[model samples]
Target: MPASSLSPYTLNNGTPTPTAAHSQPGTEVELQPYTGGDSEREVPAQATDRSERPRHIFSKHRKWMTVYMVSIGGAFSALSSNIYFPAIDTISKDLGVSATDVGFTITVYMIIQGIAPSLYGSISDSRGRRIAFVTALVVYLAANVSLAFTSDLAMLVVLRGLQAAGSAATISISTGVIADIAEPDERAGFMGTNAGIRMIGQAIGPVIGGLLNSAWGFRSIFWFLSVFSALVLLGLLIFLPETQRTIAGNGDVPLRGLYKPWSYYFKLPKEWRNAPVPPAPKLEKLSWRTIVEPLTYVLRMDILVLLSWGALVYTIWSMVTSSTTTVLLKTFPDLTQWQVGLCFLPNGIGCVFGSVCTGRLMDRAFKRAETRYREEHGLANVNVKSQHDFPIEHARLSLMPYFSVIFIVSMALYGPSYDFNDLRRHFAGNLVASLGLQFIIASTATAIFNINSTILVDCFPDNSAGATATNNLCRCLLGAAGVSVIQPMIAKLKIRNAFLVLTGIAVVFSPLVWVQWRMAEKWRRNRLGA
Candidate 1:
């Protein structure tokens, strides 16, 4: 916002007005505290659009179109991997590669998934959201198409990494887009919904892959992914408007078709694109340092501890889901790949419920906590609040204890149920534990990640995309490492002991969230001062 438009409190007593020429990143008054009488609340320019304009509006009739569109974008990246899960063995055989070689493809895909979002997020933050989404989708679509054409194992591994580069970014970019549009008050719901949608795709991918592979062959799976991604890309280019508020200047600023890497494409007729548009923030010079900056942020304590807990949570989840076939195959020796895909349904449904339920709960908690904060401080305008001022930790995490209890008890029961060679012998008991375990973990872990990520994104409102990128980088790295240890733990300690140890580890890290929550306000203060 212009200096003249800023509230007086935006600058400390006697402090000079922040000017565009003189101000630096992180120096702007991100949020103007409420000053009764005509003084308005000033949000961080990056996070708060002075103009809040968009090409599309969510009227009551179609309030969720953007969410649905963005969620589709969010889900496809995850869907790309899960859908391929059931077909992996088939692909390995078709390519004359061992099953182990097929597994290595997952490692490569994840490593790239961890790393690629940093670049995409940075690009979206600096350039604009539309182009970045298109670029990533294009790369993903190209990779999938190429994968369908190539049957060689080595090529498959490389193509999978390329696919990761394309698809891994949609989650970060989509989350950034949500932040771009929704205010913090409703963000948890949007985020929760987004997470749920991604999980739905993740949950259904294996089932779709299994059915398609069985009915039409493994090639059908890649073709299907390619077609789906291609459609999403078309929709993004046609229906989805530019959402980077900095560039779009409140949905009102007309967007130019070309932003960066995708700028060279087709030129639409005059009215199809905006006429005159405000210049976007200068694009960052893409380099090795830029690529790794997100990874380096892990050294920061607040982010590190939050991500560490989330990583641990995800590790346990991944271990269970990834090993579904291996663990269950022993019990149901005649299970088919399609049946394996169906087996994933319980976990998927649990995730969907967790995200939606926790998200709504989070919004209510934030309002309640904000009310208490205002009353305790004797503030009149409770509606005017900042992320820093709100009891965000409490708001987002109030249900964590309940979820944690669920995780601990569920894990304890789940592990022991698997001790027997014939799970069918205790099928009902195991099924109950498994479903319950997934439901709780999906809810709890996602809530934790959403809150922690919301914290960082709020910290760098201007760089919400980058903040999410760092979160993605940290969790994915930890998750991959977490996955690597599962087999060793299973081998050395046995399945029952392995899960028990995981449960203990989870309990041990539980304190980190409390510590981080306590420190959030102070950390935020320090961040603004720096």
Candidate 2:
């Protein structure tokens, strides 16, 4: 009988039953051949359906909202760190401390900002995203409000540390949230948008702090931060839905129960006899194990290493820009707080433009490369695309030339000049460096998010939140080191030479980009077996 003409049969339970026509004459009909074109057509349709399914409710309208809220929160948190720059003199006078002591406050704040995110990230994995975020914001709000009344320098440092706890966690979790919702192709775009908004806050933060401190006094800056924190908290509580996928684990299991080991201590009940057991939770307790497991995971994962290194490089570059902003403003005494704010406008514009452009370019590059590989090899296209198609090395390689230019121009601007002529040259050189800085950060950030998120999801496909939380933990630890050391390094080396030294570091590491690009194909093949 012709394959198309044979009727399919079913047993009493509705399972498919096979006849002679469906199998070899001497073989059991239960092992039927899949001979029809309909099966082939249906396979693609099923895949297409899975790929095109509507996103979760949290992902639909509130995705961008959450990004905005977290971005704003990051900006405010960052501003709290540096906004004290313009107010350093005032804070010194009011608190009866020297400039060095006031500066120490900034140093303390940076250290806390760096360390807190890693801890927050691991906590988010077990506590749920909403709880982690809301809890952080509440701590930040309390810190800000308390700061408004404190005149003691030590009190300020302690409060700032608590504030950092909230701010750092929010930024890390924000990235995790973006990872949770966006697909590999679209992740760059969303991450770019998120980074751009955060940059906007960063760009505007110093200006706002300068103005508020200049007009109403230094306490006013904390008040302003408090207001911003409150608003973000309100928005998050109202609009931001939880994105943790683990919460969907069977209704019978409590969140705490999932973490405990049942297999070694207790037997499975009758109903659970055939149910599959989940893998052991990386952290059995929230003690050192929680911290150690994430660190170990970061060390073991190649993609995570690439991302950490990229973030470290990017932060080293950022230190030059951030540390010098205040020093640069010193050259222009006539420049008001408002003017300092305006100077940041160009950096903000460059960041937004660079992020959007790089995101699109990265996506196109990945897609084109994938298409060519499929065509040249004469391989049938599969419905599901492998992560191997996205080569992060190319993304990193593209930024090398730009980074070299940034290093040269930034180093050149450090010389003394005559009158306002010197000021104009300084601003122009700084702007150029700032533009390059934005481009490097935007591109590298996109690459890190795309590669890390893809690999992480693949690694723990069933535990996306946990995987992302661990990823956040790694980046945060490295970022904290970057922020904490930048100021001390700048003080020791001076701005110009400090940047030159960093440039040398960049030069050394830039070759790794090429190394990554050359081996990416082979690495992906071996890693994913595509």
Candidate 3:
């Protein structure tokens, strides 16, 4: 093939003209003219040719609105977990349970968090995103209401797990929804937006939890969550369209009965929304196989390695956040619940900042990778087929080392922030210095988490939710272990030593990213063949 043939459009004086780009003997679809710059690239012929690319009915505005809704949906999981942070001590005392027993509630929550997504992802992938989301929210709403009235430790632990089952899958389902609507090149930005919005829950949950706990006791936290979730669920039922590609291909399929949101009737133009389209395919019956499907990705060495690295990073971060209230109260005995909650403000700020920035950075990296692919292949302005040609792993992981360094340094300093002996002697004695370190730690770690999530979606574009569920399973389980041990570790080996251990673990796990980077392409190709 000639170098000029690489691009779909013929360049006329540096402008792309309408033309067929790729017409290889085995090519499935011919590329149409490139519309303009990087932003307005040619729509895939398959999009219009249903026999090839299913038509995408969502306008850009509609697609983004879907993202925002799912982002809010995903945020409930983070909100539920983070909101409980400030109430740990209060809940323990109220239930007449040991702090360790209270921590068990988190462990159960994490365990459910790990497992529930697989089931939810399966439902979302097969049945529909809307149904899966609605189901999860209903369960979550019920759990919150029950939790508000519970005074028993066992009940609290069980209710938390039910809450996890309800909310944990939102992250996976949201990723699946993004995959349904976005192309490989632009996925990170959308994923980043989703994550950024979700991180808001993480950032503000403690503050809200703290204030609510102080004002009306810890039970009020559950009441707030119940009310918030109910509102979100109502909005979702009314406005959130189904985005599972299998069911609502390209958002073109006119859904019926429960499949269609109320917005389908009012928000969309009747002609466009009611356009003739293929009927939804028969959904597979949910079985053990569907539940086990996500685990298959875990068996892939490259994905496993990537997941392991993410689990390590997430576990470290979870340990910190889970223990923060306890640590702050111990360090400053006079600190009230609200005061301790305020301490989390920096970390939350970092999460929001990091998620958004990392997403934009990932998009830029993908664009750079596209440019590099063209240069290497001696092509001009051609659309490099993302799945087969783009250096996706490298583009996504390019910023991993920087984040790793940030995490390591910040985590090391984090423990010492509370060590009065060290803080008094060192220049890092001030409150600002302490919180600044937390901010850095949260930002960098959250960036790493987002990067892993972005790459996972890239690797399994068709099964984005399933892939993310696998990631959630790994990280949440590891996080459960980390949360289980962190408080005890801090008690036995001062916060400083415990964090140093975490930092060392991060260093030890750093090479896993390199391994995944090296092997990702090969593994993906092998999977395709299989």
Candidate 4:
């Protein structure tokens, strides 16, 4: 490429800005914000028009409804995992396998869950969110149907991985849709609501799974999922719109065929119906790089710290939830599958509540941070020049310390709550103790989750899905590790000591959040060479 063709320019000042030509040989330019002037062409004549300002074409109601619609898919993704928790024992018995063998199903599911989203996110980031959503649902629906008919343990594990491959995309895609619609300042509430809904699916899965398993056998759980996913898939086909900016261009661009939501066929105004569909933008090629893009984000120190912090909480929560059935069964040997599933309700409820409250709190924090930034820089009443200059890390990380404390304290108490003998003799019944502790731990973990998720998307606005996939990748791998060994760890060290060890590990890493908060902007600037 020519030197001029490789350069970028600023519109307002006509200043030559840095490009690959300006960077040292062999150094990667990680993040370069769009500077509005392509060196290969003249600046567009219409660029000066204030009336042509780029903005989302969606109405407020439509934006939120779109989020809610996609969240159902996210919920299904989570439900796929959580619903299986209650069936572990039943599946073990029916498949003539040990509980440890059944645990591999969860592990395999999580592994695929971690790996598959990079593909989905890459596709959605380039092709369109609708295609990604539709493809995932179709694959997931087929997987669930297969799982319902399978009797072999090895087949069950393999099918579980296939199921994960399909459903896991919804999570990253859901966050991507939020990025496509909401502004950075307003994203927390939207993300919170989405995450909360997703967490709710995870929360209630065991209850539904237990009920279905107890009444209709473990196969019924897969049957229920197949039906629920088909309904969700129908809803997406009918109502979900293409929101990927590269494809939809703020919702005004006409979409055709699979890219167009069924409702848009009649609901779009006559002008849009009659308008021409522009040639689709070139999509990112599906290659090794696209599949591995999320993994590359792990190389960034700031993202690494943020991912570690979030993954630690996620892994601990996974350990706690996975162990719930085993510990509860040991504590209350007479408890039925339904009762064991019902015990998870409080934890789920807490996650839902925490997500809502923390979302509003994060929005408030953003406003406060923005206000302070404006005052400090003497730019009151004006938006920051660009999000790059804003202190988003501070705004988002403000709540981490408080929530981290809550998580640690509750996590430390969670293990002892499993001690039925002590619980019966001293405080409350073992059931009540365990549920209460689980509730607190789950709620706090969710609050931290909302914070981490919001910041991750804000940092990578263009690649929100990819960023979230990276977050999922980290958490799922760590969670798999935590869950796979939790039983043995608990057996060898005792639940109380094992939990204490987990708590100490979290304590050691908790400061990384602080480190990220303090150093994120510096790291970002270094990458941008600002």
Score every model by TM-score.
Answer: 0.84, 0.70, 0.87, 0.90
Backbone clashes in model 3, listed as residue pairs:
8-21, 46-53
How would you encode candidate 2's per-residue C-alpha lDDT over 1-530 as one tens digit per residue? 45475465423224454443442221111121233554421111111233433223343455666567666655655556656666766778898997667766665666666567667766666555666778888998999999999779899878877877777677666766665555545555666676666666555666777788778998998898888889878776655555544542321222234233233135433434565655533433456666445555454334544555555554653454455445455545566655565555444454455555555655665566556655765544332233335444454245434543553344334322212245464454544554445444434443344444444544443334445555555544555555556666756865556666765665566555555556644554555444
List, residue by residue over 239-314, the lDDT tens digit for candidate 3: 8877776677666567776778897677765545547655657887888897788788878777888888889999
Each prediction's RMSD over C-alphas, in Å, is 5.1, 11.0, 6.9, 4.2
Residue 437 CA error for candidate 4 (Å)? 1.4
Instruction: Tell me the tens digit of each residue's lDDT in model 1 across 1-530.
Output: 45566544334344434433334443222333334446554433333342343223334233266777878887876688778777766777788887557767776777788888999998888777887888999999999999888768889889999999999899888887777766656677777888888878867888898899889888888899899998888777766766776665445455554642232245443443655555655556767675666666566665676677776777677777665655555556566788867877777777777777777878888778777876787665423333345556566667766776777677776777665435354344545555566566656666666666665654555667777887777667766676656666776787778888888888787777677667755664565453
Compared with the true structure, what per-residue lDDT tens digits does model 4 show for residues 12-51? Answer: 3455534434533212122223445443433321223322
Task: Return model 2's CA RMSD, one decimal.
Answer: 11.0
- Model 4 scores a C-alpha lDDT of 0.81
Worst 10 residues of 4 by lDDT: 24-33
TM-score winner: 4
Answer with 2 or 3, whichever has the higher TM-score. Answer: 3
What stretches of model 2 exceed 4 Å from their correct place?
1-49, 52-66, 248-291, 373-494, 520-530
Task: Please rank every candidate by lDDT, starting with the best.
Answer: 3, 4, 1, 2
